[model samples]
Target: MKRYWKYIRPYLGAFILAPILMLTEVFGEILLPRLTSMIINNGVLERNEAYIVKMGIIMVLIAVIMAIGGIGAAYYSAKASISFSTDLRKDVFHKVQEFSFKNIDDFSTGSLVTRLTNDIQQIQNVVMLTLRMMFRAPGMLIGGLIMAYLMNRQLVSILLVVIPVLVILIAIILVVAFPRFEVMQKKIDRLNSGVQEALTNVRVIKSFVRETHEEEKFKTTNRDLKEGSLNAMKVVITAMPLMMLMMNITTIAVVWYGGNLIIAGRMPVGDLTAFTIYIVQILMSLMMLSMVFLQASRAMASLKRVKEVLDTEIDLTDEQASEKSAQIAAGKVEFKNVCFQYTKGTEDLVLDHINFTANPGETIGIIGATGSGKTSLVQLIPRLYDADEGEVLVDGINVKDYSIRNLREGVGMVLQKNVLFSGTIEENLRWGNETAGMDEIILMSESAQAHGFITSFKDGYDTDLGQGGSNVSGGQKQRLCIARTLLKKPKILILDDSTSAVDTATEARIRQSFTTTLKNTTKFIIAQRIGSVEYADKIIVLDEGKIAGIGTHQELMETCEAYQEIYYSQKDREKEAGA
Candidate 1:
């Protein structure tokens, strides 16, 4: 509640004004029934035509006042609720942006999306309803009961039996409905995940001829969501019928009891007429109050889900760093007896006791079998994941000492999976350096060997890319990503199997450009083909998470058995002319 004050404070005037305005309607309704009794008893019985006309004119004025209050109340509630939701959604989005990779793993992408959109919408509806009915319903109930009791106390006693029964039933329904809503929300998360996965990989599903299998899988998730929603709604269905039954039964009982009194001459006909209207008003007020509670039950579940994201403790931050202002310089990287696992407390290590060093301006090539922790080793330098048991140092300082933004900006990585946004080619490249000039952008593209194809397009650099660069070929996408990273001109550059899709000739030219354009930049290239790293200044051969060899290509073939096996197995052995 204290946390929500920021969102509510700005709209406090509208929040307070909505309920106050609703009171005018409550006063108008209560006064209307009593005025009707005056018209019948005083004006009609005495045959005073003048009095009847005066009362009619007064009643019309009160009705006009009620309409104004009702509209004003609606305007203020809308003003408050919409503004509140907008600010709340912004804060939730900003909190998500602060999440570390590990923090994001705690919740599914679908769940976060649902929380940001659907959950907040539910709470907004409740806010509007609560403002309109918070005081209006209770005011109607008390006013109606008082007027009815004054008209004839005996007739009002019928409500004692009906109100308690309806209250008990509503309480029971609310308790049963809450857990069902929680389950329904979880079902929505699964359905969203299924839809996102299927659409994102539509091409793969088509190529593999798995459309039928995917359709069946989606149907199963959709059916589960349908069942869960129906299960929750069953409580609402049961509740409405019971409330209507009690209301009708009480209304009939009141009229029947009051009719006997009228015939016996114990109660006036005008008083009985007004009393019946009051009975209906009291029952309707009870219904409005019950509805408020019902919507609130669902909103409570959403509130908890939203709070979970805000309360998450990020595993990575510069909060405790002694040197938060430290920057990466010279690009000398070292891993001292590093040990890491994806899951903490697990004995199965991804990189076990890894030790390595790359001097400034050196070209370090890492080659190994699949799942040899090649990607894991380079990721540590950027502080993407902290090593579980050792230190990763950059420029003679612990990587943790530097802020995450500063550390990552200093090390540019062209990931194995190339991703591009739905924008012009120039826009995607600008993500590396937002202030880079057009001339600098073109120079990097030329170095990456992407300028040739880009210029051949009719729109050149202004050509719009589809989602994830879907309009481009795999080889072209790889070069664009390389060009984007090159625009940063970082002290340390990593190519993680980035050129695997390009032709050998183009790859060689791209490598050659690096010598002149980035002569002082430290480069780490992880490759599957030995030819890619054969001419490197230093080559590290990895076998099962441990470094098997560390030297130039020629030195590794002479001494390291693991390196000799890889060298003899590859087509590079042919290129070396039967070395």
Candidate 2:
């Protein structure tokens, strides 16, 4: 919560001005009843119509002043609150972007989304409400009580009893309800996670005919959320009725005591009337305070949740050491005894003492069974994840020494799952090179074998794509992603099973075209298919995170049993399909 003040600090003038205006409005409201007392006791009792009319005009003037002040206060409060939330949201988004893969994995995507949207919205509403009501409520309550006592101290005795009872009740309610609100937020995160998962895998649910099962799962989570919300509401509902009951009792006592006093000639009728109004004002003000506190309690919970994300220190930072004057020649990579594991204090390493190097213009193919760490190995070259034990060098300098922007710009990587943003085809291509011209786009698209289909669209380069490229086929999305990478013309290109969705003929055409156009770029291709790796300059076979074989196709066929088994198994599948 303190960290969030950086955003609020700029709005300090508005924050102060809003409450001051609100206090003036509250002062006007408090003074109105006293003016009424004077009108009733002096004018009506003395039979002075002129005095009554004059006081009446003064009352109307006070109301007008309050109205104007209220509006001004509301305007400033709204402006400050909105600006505060906008700045806070921007800061949160930027912090999330800076988080490393390890930090992201600790908080799942659905939970992070909930924090960014729902949690922040909760805090924003509370800030706006607090600025509007904080000064007005307290001042009205205290000022009304002081005025009521000064008007007639005899009737004020009831308030001494009433205020304490209400305070105790509110205190108990807050204590019980505060913890429940935190739990309710966690439940919402779980519900959001469940819904996000079901939506993302709707295709899988339909293909497996498991719609009923998915529906049941969603129902269970929805019920859990409902129950949590209902329980919290129940606490609030129970406490509110008790508060009302206390206020009602105080009202009855005021009327009872004041009536007795009036009958005995101990109090003036107008004075007693004003006293009752002041007591009601005090009670109402306390109720408003309780309401504000309730919201503040929930906002406190939300504030803590939002602060957790902002407080997370970035795990990776660029080295402050002076730059060494060594130059890394283009397309050269070396991993010296590199090892990694996702978690610390774990005996199992994902990649073990791995040593490998690829020279300029060479095509290195990585083939492995599932979970053999092929993707993880390539991720190190771009410094996506630092190695646990040894150095990963691109050119000649350790990757850790390079700035993140410099490191990523030199490497073009297409992940196994291709993703496209919502934009025109040309806008998406510009992500690779912002200044790429139409001719450059066409050349790269054709080289990646994507131009023919792209030009088939009604708008070609101007064709608008849906989010995640949902409007395009899987193979087409892969091709566009490949073309986008090709436009970068990076020194090292990494394709992580990027062509898996394309037909064999199209894959062969793309590969052949790439080989000719990307002659100066080193390519690292990871594939499950034997055919994909067969054309590589050299192939490395990984078995259980260890390199079992490293050689060309002909060399591995005679010497590596693991390579032979994989090759023959893929051959048998091809033969069966052909037959």
Candidate 3:
């Protein structure tokens, strides 16, 4: 919470002015009851109409002043709080953007989203309440006590008993409620995860006719959240009733004792009247202070969650890079005894002692079974995750020597899971090269065998795509993704099973275009089908985490056991289908 003050310091003027204005209201409140007492004693009892009228006018003026001060205080406190939240949210978002894939994996997507939205909102509300109540509540409590004691110290004796009990109750509530709120927040995170997962896989759920199962899962999560929230609120709600009971008892005691003093002529009726108002003020202030403490406790949990993201050190920053390159003039890649694992110190390595090389303008093919580290291997080139041991080199220089932006810009990759945004075709294409001209875009589309279908659309390149390219066929989405990458004109291009949805004829044409248009670019094609990579200059076969074979398709078929097994199995499946 103290660390977050940098965001608040800029709004210090508003913070300062809000409490100062609230002081005016607090003083007016204290003065108003005394003025009423004066009217009851000197003006009404003595039948002094002139004194009554004068004091009444003064009371009206003070009321107006209190009204203005309260309004100003509310305005400034809101300004300070809202602005503080806005800056804090922006900072949290920027910090998330800097997170490496490993860093992101440390927290679930739902947890991060909750911290950004719900948790930040909780903190904002607490800040606003604190600004309004922090000074006003304490001042009112202290000032009310001073005024009550001055009027007649005898009436103040009741507070001695009530204050200690109220303090103890508040302390107990904080002790019990703090941990409950923390647990409740974790429950909210789980609830959010349930909702996010259900929405993201709604299509799968519907296709499988599992709507009832999904509903049950959601109900279970919702019930847990409900129960946790109730448990936390029970602690809070219990305090309110107990505080009010104590307050009523104190009021009754004050009146009973003050009445005896008034009748004995030891205390004036007016003094007794003023004493009651001060007592009410004192009790109400304590109640407000207790409520403030409860809110602060809840906000403490959210602050800790938010601080976790802000304090996370980005693992993939370019600060360690000692050199920068303007462009990847040549696409030559090599891996030397590389080993990597998703989790550090894990026994299972995703890629084990991997060694491979691709020369400028060469076409390389990667073939492997599922979970064979194909994607993990390509990701290392872009520095998405650094190798746990050994080295990855591009253009004869160690990859870690180059800045991440420069490294990634030079390598264009079309991932296995192609994604398209909700926008016009041109907009999605421009993500690869924002300054690309219309001719360049069309040429890349044609090379990727996407131009014909795109031109057939009524709006041509202006056609809008649905979210995740839901409106287009899988083949079309893959081609569009390929064209998008081609527009970058990168020195190295990687397609990770990107053409799987396309027919072999279309795939062949796309490959032919790659040979002609991307003659100078080194290319890597990772495919499950032998036909897709049979024409490549060299194909590498991966078994488990190690390279099983590396050669031309003919050489691999002759010399590699793993390659022979995959080729014959695929050939047998095709023959069975053909028959």
All candidates' TM-scores?
0.95, 0.96, 0.96
lDDT of 3 by residue, 154-195 (tens): 789889989999999999999998899889888999989989
What are the per-residue Cα lDDT tens digits for candidate 2 across 1-579? Answer: 476678879999988888888987998979988888788899999999999999999888889989988998999999888888888888888999988888888897878888888888888888888988888889989899899888778788888988998899888878887888898888889889988988877878899999999999889988988998888777778867877888888888988999999899988888877887888789888888888888878878888888899889877656542343333359799989999999888998899988989988899999989999899899898877889989988887788887776778889999988989999999998888999988999999998888998999999999999777878889999999999999998989999999999998999998898778888888999999989989899898988888999999999999999999999999999999999
* Backbone clashes (count) for model 3: 0
| Candidate 3, residue 577: how far the Cα is off, in Å | 1.3
**Model 1: residues with Cα > 4 Å off, grouped in runs:** 44-47, 572-579
- Candidate with the larger lDDT of 1 and 2: 1
lDDT of 1 by residue, 465-515 (tens): 988888899999999999999999989999999999998899899999999
Instruction: Pull out the clashing pairs in model 1.
Output: none
Model 2 pairs in collision: none
Native-structure RMSD, model 3: 1.7
What's the count of clashing pairs in each model shown? 0, 0, 0
Better of 1 and 2 by TM-score: 2
Candidate-wise lDDT, in order: 0.90, 0.87, 0.92
